[model samples]
Target: MSTSGSKDMSRRHVLGALAALPTLPILPVLFGASVARADDAPPPLPSWNDGPTKQAILDFIHATTDPSSKDFVPAEERIATFDQDGTLWVEQPIYTQIIYCLARVPVLAKANPHLAKVEPFRTVLTGDFEKIAKLSLRDFETIAVATLTGMDVEAFAAEVKAWIAEARDHRWKKLYTELTYQPMQEVLAFFRANGFKTFIVTGGGQDFVRVYSQRVYGIPPEQVVGSALGTKFGYDKAGRPFLTKEPKLLLNDDNAGKPEGIHLEIGRRPHAAFGNSTGDRQMLEYAKAGDGARLSMIVLHDDASREYAYGPARGLPDTRVGRFPQELDDEAKKGGWFIISMKDDWKRIFAFE
Candidate 1:
């Protein structure tokens, strides 16, 4: 995926709501269309609690979309990029992609028997999650690179699709897809309803996410930009064309690389950006640098009861996965980025909740 922030909507953005009179009647229109009663209308963001965070989101959308506003942006220019892991969904304990990579180790080892004797692969084969979590970054890179490469693009995607459908997060015994945050899902739909185009800019495997983005998040495959594997083109014996996944890394869609990927893939700067970690800091900065009204928001994982919370930010807890450093938190405060508190802002964590 081409990896690609504003926190606050001030008075200019906080638009007046259209309130209905008590005497007004809901009427059916000419072509059998009916006026939606204010009470019957679904809330813009139902999962979000009534607070400044929710209001800020609505205000930004209205300010940019309203023709009367100075910040009014043409619909085509309304682009919002989101980071996938901690921002859009859970990334605590272990990342979904890392789990997928590690799961494939036994199969890979079976094919190349010698791999079973290796350090990381052997640890991975142990099937003990605690030990696996302790594996070094270098070890994960080795496992991920091995698992992700050595297949045709179509075959690779197909494998991921099948796996995603069956993979369940051990904690909740729910499918990974079911673990998605309800508030974020509402934000996505709300943005689309307001004529904004949304893109998933993840640091996870590009092809892995593309397999399920549309089905799970309503984001199409082409709109995804992420860390990718290199590919080579060739023909089979029957002259059928195919692209083979290579071991070499192409784009690293994280940190400073995020803006670079966005520029390369999207061409235009996004009006807004959302993320949840230090990796997302540069992307948020990039969005804020854009002209006109912009938003830079961070989803601070501070609700351990509802969801896993680990941010060395505000001294919640420290974690190797999805780390939210105090330094990033300080920068967000100074930069005017909204730090979304899941505990206070969300009425529910998952849709299942």
Candidate 2:
């Protein structure tokens, strides 16, 4: 039989088996929402379809984690790095961090007063969202520094916490943290359940993500690594010590910087890596370079009905934020990394769905 015909036959066999199984009571396995189970524990990646993408993860996990498997890796050596933004949750239209920055600009302008007259700041202050949305990444970075820094670390954290608590995604009317992808959350939990140490390596600010990483993703602040600005050691007026957020670039934890950040912060190469954009290409490459049973996956944003779709990868809409360019898609295919189609592989995207 030809290869394509054989694969079709195999798929039919799998589907036939699935259709034969009785629908039984399932032990609850939801991301943040759960009900009591009656008998059997539910399968991992319930939000994921029973396809090659899900099968690859299952195969990798069993091979590396089973004691009798030849590919079994030592517990301490099982490190998985994940890129944030589109990989975990939503990064369409604009990044959630950038949204936070946009919200902060007016508040900061109110406090500082003089900043209201600045170009991007002036544009932001006008409340014309069309113009604000068109602001460049560099412009947003400047606005982020202006709003998120200058204050002491604690104050910066407190403000972020406050905003995160109250801020909702404009489209969904849910908290931004609540917008995390349910399938990805299951992946994180499954990796941890199998002795893998999961770390978030993002292009976002380190200190900013740290404030809510624990509550949002269940990853501790220490395990989060991201692009970082500098801080100054000093004392407050009460003779207490504090670290002020300074205007200095420390690490740019995206693309090529991701591998460097992993080396510096993790002290070892990851066994598995997951990402969603061109910015994460190098991290995926670094993970694939590791010896023995490595896996790299990219979450392709190709579903528009359930969520926003913008991937120049498979002729989807081109987007500035979290771009999945055609070349990057080609590299993933050539490099033997899995491209997870959001439209097909994911049964559901967000938990709310």
Most lDDT-accurate candidate: 2
> Number of the top candidate by TM-score?
1
Candidate 1 segments exceeding 4 Å error: 1-34, 37-40
lDDT of 1 at 244: 96
Residue 151 in model 2: shift from native, Å? Answer: 1.2
lDDT tens per residue, model 1, 19-54: 332323432342122223322346578898988888
Report the lDDT tens digits of candidate 2 across residue range 171-221.
Answer: 899999988999999999888877899999999988989999999898999
lDDT scores for all predictions?
Answer: 0.84, 0.85
TM-score of each model, in listed order: 0.90, 0.88
Q: Over 4 Å off in model 2, which ranges?
A: 1-39, 136-138
The CA lDDT at 197 in model 2 is 92
